[model samples]
Target chain A: MIRSEQIEPCAAAEHSGAWARRHVLDIEDFSVPEIELVMQTTSAMKEILSRPLKKVPALRGKTVVTLFYEASTRTRGSFEMAAKHLSADVVNMTAQASSVTKGESLINTLNTIEAIGADIIIMRHPLSGAHYCAAPHVKANLVNAGDGWHAHPTQALLDLYTILNRKGRIAGLKVVIVGDVKHSRVAHSNIWCLTKMGANVVVCGPPTLLPEGLKTAQLLFPGIGVETNIEKAVKDADVVMELRLQKERMQSGLLPGLRDFIAGYQLDSKRLALTKPDSIVMHPGPVNEDVELAADVLHGGRSVVNDQVTNGVAVRMAILYLLAGSREQ
Target chain B: MPSKVVITSDEMRRSIARMAHEIVERNKSTENLLLVGMRTRGVPLAKRLAANIATFEKIPVTVGALDFTLYRDDLNQRQPSVKGTDIPGTIDGKAVVLVDDVLFTGRSARAAMDALIDLGRPEVIQLAVLVDRGHRELPIRADYVGKNIPSSKDEDVQVKLAETDGMDEVRVASQE
Candidate 1:
């Protein structure tokens, strides 16, 4: 029996009006209450995950298909696990093996999946705004896993869950995102989610690696700080999130060199000392060993990188549960 | 449609005390006994019963809250939110007594059993309900029933507890 020691009788009643969105494309338009509702549902899903029998019949008989146009390991695996844990039938398709290699259009593939009775489609593409093109082509619910540098909402949500689990809150905390912010979908999504939740967000990277319109974008969404100096960005920081630096940036001349980038911006012991004592270290995995973050920091006690992966499944479960059941409203 | 109070606060307390004594008499002692309550009102009732058993037998009993929303049969008809199930420890080889406020359809009791069996094997599983109103759709009968209220199918039996609602009472009203 799956049991919770603290069962709030009015918890379900409180979140009755919390979810109505048919698709989860981005966190830029999510209200605070909606985010809180997702966190609340994630907490409940976490309890289910803790049980010996980590299976729930909430999405039983529902068909969930994961359509990936980009190569992925954690996101695709966790989405598949989340669907399977909820007792849903899952079908996974990759661009390399699927009809995409045969030049089948994205719309035709979506229509084929819909015709095969897919209740939900989770897609990750290499192009930005891929979900917008796919959303209108099918009535099935669409979840954006990661689309170029546009948004990775589930990754941001699990990061938020990890930060909240560690720090107990998101507001009034200094969160410094380190690495190639211009090319990281994780960084973009976290910027929106953290700022919307009242966190003081500061993006730290080399001038060439930072987005071009960041200074002007700050005018639209205030309290977002952009700093080129790593030392100044880590000062009094509460959360230091390291994004994976793509090696292609060096070839593109956006970064001078890997050695220069690491010496200037790597989150090592020296830079970590600048943050608060209780501050946490985070990285959306596939860490580059020593490029963006030190190996010690990635495996240290303060690092919640593994917990973020574990929470990723629960967060996706909550999102799938909410979106699949939204039709009942 | 008119509503009338069927069980008052004082009667609720007395009925709970009697049920506790009956449970102890049937099980012979409170040893290795677990009290699992359905969500909403059954949680407080189980706590109250544990307190009563502790007062009489001087032995504390384990209580758990069971929320079987996922195991419910009406998933396709309506989307019910999950309230979560919480058990303190293992239920293996223990005599479990499932508690609920009112028993009408017997479907919830069946779902609760399915949810319980998924965790572990209990030595013996028994049902204890405060009010066992007639019209059971399944072949399930309570081991200890506080009161049996027989009424028309259109009438609704509402059980409100002070832990949840502002008062403790059982009311019967015509369905609107």
Candidate 2:
């Protein structure tokens, strides 16, 4: 386990003002260097945030656009706060307000953001691979905040930061991601980050949401297992991440009802009982009352859902700070 | 901090030769023996020791690396970051030597021992160090010490070897 005593926070990697060309869309496929680059940079950003006057000039004089066509308060606000902390200007574009509401197509809006001297665009859209489709069209660096069920790279990164901070190491860890595995971008992104860092992973959910034919997780790690039993999946787990079931899950007919989903997949104190003693509980919130997690568990000692939210600012700060400072290896 | 003109690379080579001779003479053979380096610098030192022993006895030597970051109890005292424990080989019933550069805080040595226990129990264990600047907090002692130069606690000793950082030098900088 990671010891949290007297640790002099690491200084951010010396940004030579040459690191402004990087972009993060998915954590599943990030190389070890890329991951470390983010981790090391995040370490320094965390230290910076600990100060009273928390803002930095690392990302000053740059344009960071938050393009979210999905409902999110934590993710969007964290990005806004992080960019603000780094002294960068922010532009928020949701489908509700943007020309995207008038059928302006993803490409046109992305192109417009590009033409407006936008230095960066942080996006979260409901449509799968929408960011990938807009990646080529946008001239500025694109950060996929949450792109449908495909991947939420930054969320996974923040989750990893939580684990690394609490546990101190990533290798040989047993991480179990529970609930809505099929439609969870957090679970998907975690499969890549945890596996890449040499942690054994198990994705467990109800049979309907946890399907077969996951090629990305398997392609990166051929030995990963996908299970359905919450008990068997979470046994001896060092870290267990519970994902919130999107409202679309029921509309998609994958879940029968909320009562049944909670009975099977909810991580209450009883379900949390099955995990390792020192295990930490995590969630990407707006948690369903009794579906994905219980109220007590979310507020209890093990829950890092709140910490996960706070770390989002730190992680994003690291990403932008690193990308803004140096593009050199 | 004393300006100790620490051992040169040639001096290092001779000390390793002597240490290698002592290890072989005491054990009578390399059987059940393994050299495990304690991270960045000790790893190469173990390789060199293994190489020297192989040359002396015409028998193969098993070399492994043990990173102590995970086992450290001082992380909470210092900095919160991820430093992993990577053990590339097994340590079942073997005689092990924990190799390191500077044995100052002794916390790192203590952590290395804890990490080794998780890997497997060794029949016998010993310590080897390139430098042992005595400001011991724990009751640990190095079994094989290349150089024992006493120094103040504020001094930082960095060892660079040609195999790793393209040069062999020991610099003692004042702690910031």
**Top TM-score prediction, candidate number:** 1
Candidate 2: regions farther than 4 A off = A1-21, A215-220, A326-329, B1-176
Which structure among the candidates has the greatest DockQ?
Answer: 1
**Candidate 2: tens digits of C-alpha lDDT, residues B1-176:** 44444777788888888787777876777988888888768988888888889999999888777655534564323322332233444576889888898898788898788767756678888888988999899999998888887677878777888887898777676654
The C-alpha interface RMSD of every prediction is 2.9, 13.8
For model 1, what TM-score is found for chain B?
Answer: 0.97
TM-score (0 to 1) for chain A, all models? 0.96, 0.90
Model 2 chain B worst lDDT window (10 residues): B76-85
Runs of candidate 1 with Cα error greater than 4 angstroms are A1-13
- lDDT tens digits by residue: candidate 2, A214-304: 6665775886878788878888889888888877788888888888878777888887888889999988787776677788988899988
Assess the local accuracy of residue B16 in candidate 2 as a C-alpha lDDT between 0 and 100: 85
Clashing pairs in 1: A1-B119, A3-B85, A3-B86, A4-B85, A4-B86
